[model samples]
Target: MAKKANWKELMTLHLRAYIPALVAFLFLLPSPVFAAALSLSPTNASVRVGSTVTETVFVLSTDQAMNAISGTISFPPELLQVVSVSKAGSVLSLWVQDPTFSNADGTISFSGIVPNPGYTGSHGLTISIQFRGKRAGTAAISFSPSSQVLANDGNGTDILNDTNSATITVTSSASAPSTPPAPSTAEQGLLARIISSTHPDQTQWYNRPHAIFDWTNAQGVSGVRLGYDKDADGEPSVPYSEPLSHKELDLEDGIWYFHVQEKGSGGWGPISSYRVQIDTVPPLPSTVTFPQGTTTPSGSSITALFTTTDELSGIDHYQVAVDGKVFTVTADAGSRPYQVSAGPGAHMLLVQTYDKAGNFSTANGRFFVTGEASSFFDFFSFGWLAVNYISIFLIAFAILVTLLFAAWYIRTHFMAYRYRLNRQLGLTHAHVHKEFDTLKEAITEELLALEQTKSKRSLTREEERLIVRFKKLLDHAEQTIEKEIEDIQR
Candidate 1:
């Protein structure tokens, strides 16, 4: 018993001694720390009032890879005005929302997505903003609380930990020129006019693989040498012998600079470079989903989300067409819901998304609007006119039944009453005529007998008087009977 108690006490002492150590070990273990940082380069800057300074936005990653970033930057509009926002050489593959700035509002918003494998290094350029100092004051530019750095992980976890800002000190000075001066007429006459039908604007992007460049050879120009490649400053190296004024190139999808040098009488003149941007494949198909089911009451609302990315140039705009009424929304406004002014029925939401390169893909979405809360004006809508077939049929059927009931009622009631009245009047007229004829015949016979008796014997005084009175009575009766017969005929 003594040995057993000693062993148990030793075990208890050991347990009490190690419990604190175990807890400390657990606490000392390295915990996962997110180190994604959004910062502005040259945290300090200086410029005179009316002069311009550019500030760059960058994302710094520690060990984890980040795939998306979005933020709104705020500044003092009274002291500084945003000149422009440039996305040149940005590491992000696609712009979720095109960078926009407002000088009056003193804010800039940017959101973009990186392709697979994402960006992992420091100095991942997001955008550069040029600001003009408007007053002599210290201006602070910093990311708003809305800024976020999303990890490349499938779930898009936000790992943004720290955000750094910039400080700018502006002094009073004169404003710079609003724009650069145009080239002189003589300088413009020196270079050949370059034109392309397929890629008309050098700044614009197109999906056409075949790029046709046309130029007019000037006087005294014998030969022209041209180079086409990704290098913006490279000139024609190989000697050219083609005399044609046009050249067509079948190029892969990338930015290419076309450099042309005309061999004038004196020698090769200055090279004029034109940029051509192409993307043959359209943007990948996007699945537009609604949080609410495809069926929604007419009075309710539905939200649609479009998640699409372009490998090269980013999406520019989106179009939604329902019930033949088409409207457009920019990618920045893509988060907005499409207004459905259609009647209750199945509607095909024709969606057309266009990239910056003008490459586009057509997609279809369907939604059914229940007739739960329809307005009276919906009957006059074009969608109602074309699609409200059931309502129209019901109305037509009701009208037809109403017309049939009216015809039956008229035939049974009014027509029968008219026939009965005419019949009753006809019988009464016949009876009156027969009674009048019988009475007249009887009176005529009595008078005729009396007149014969008078002619056969000598007339007494009483007989003559009676005969006169009977004649008068017969005359009055005839007049009254004729009046009664006329009334009956009428």
Candidate 2:
């Protein structure tokens, strides 16, 4: 018991570590894992050679909430030719791969997932097939033994069970309508399937009130009785005479079912139903937002969350636009944060989400992008890098100051040099030699006058002192002028 307990404890710890990964893995699963019975409607039927017949494939019964389903229906290519396949009123919310068929392979294949709360019903339609009879023979339609179903059963378990197949007996006038023979109740369950043309896709919500339903009227079939209502088991009450192959209705905005029956000489046949979903109103107005607030750090991308809801048909796709330019249209990112690529600036983000019915709602918000410049290139786009804003501003300020100081110093030195050149050339300065010569002659004459005055009157003490200062000044002036002239010439 201790060993067993320890083993369970270890497993619990392991699961705890992987819980997130497991949840993600299960959420994306496209096949149901619950044990469910799969069956083809009208399990047995007879078709005239060269004529077409319709069959529906759906989940017959399941006790668990199955989230995903996948299957392949195989038929004998020699006896039956593939006509078409439709998933109009299917229970699948998302198709991993759309239903497709190949006549050469005699197979119809589909893989899809249902939303959470999965699907629990007797008749969860998966897909419908139309096959044409080629010759007189028995063509058996059966699900491949390896069909799959997935469920949210606390574990990612995949469970599949045996299938209830259909037997198609193609004949050559063996049971002609002119001399009709009674068929087994199963073979005559529904002679044909109901199909819509004006509202072809049952999964899509449409605004058009006008609808047209068409069906194949088997041989000897006279009138058709049909009923339009919201009830699933709605019976056919209105009757039209023979040769009627279609019916038309102008319906209101709601889910509607068209029940149809055909009457030959033997009385009313079994009824079949077709679904028509109508939604004229658009998705409720909602917003798309950036989780990191409206303003984001300048980066390569920003994530947007769309909060648009549709109660009737559900949300389908989302389109994102930045600064009036459409960026991306996505179906996967509708429920999650969608990443948007934009340059740093004030940006207008316009987001639009569409419902499965083609109705859309729009919301927009404004945001700014900024950051430290990554490199020299960032200087041009200044705030788009991952650097500190204060630091970037300070660095830019210092660079501007340095550039201005350098320019000032260069201008100052150039002006000083030009002043010296002008002094010698005399364009913007006093001519050094000419002015010096004038000053020298005046000084020499003044000195002579001072000496003469001194000799004339033994000179007053002031006169003697003046003569001495004049001689010294003239001598100093001569030496300074000579040096400047020599330097300018050099």
Per-residue lDDT tens digits for candidate 1, residues 46-117, read: 867755677899899868999999999999999998865767689877988878777888899989999989
* lDDT minimum window of 10 residues, candidate 1: 174-183
lDDT by residue for model 2 over 106-131, one digit each (tens)? 98889998887788877889887877
- True-structure RMSD for candidate 1: 20.8
Per-model CA lDDT versus the true structure? 0.79, 0.77
Error of model 1, residue 51, in angstroms? 19
What local lDDT does model 1 show for residue 304? 71
Q: Which residue runs does candidate 2 get wrong by more than 4 Å?
A: 1-190, 203-207, 300-303, 324-332, 371-490
Error of 2 at 217 (Å): 1.9
Tell me the TM-score of each prediction against the true structure: 0.41, 0.38
Error of 1 at 119 (Å): 6.1
Could you tell me the C-alpha RMSD of candidate 2 in Å? 22.4
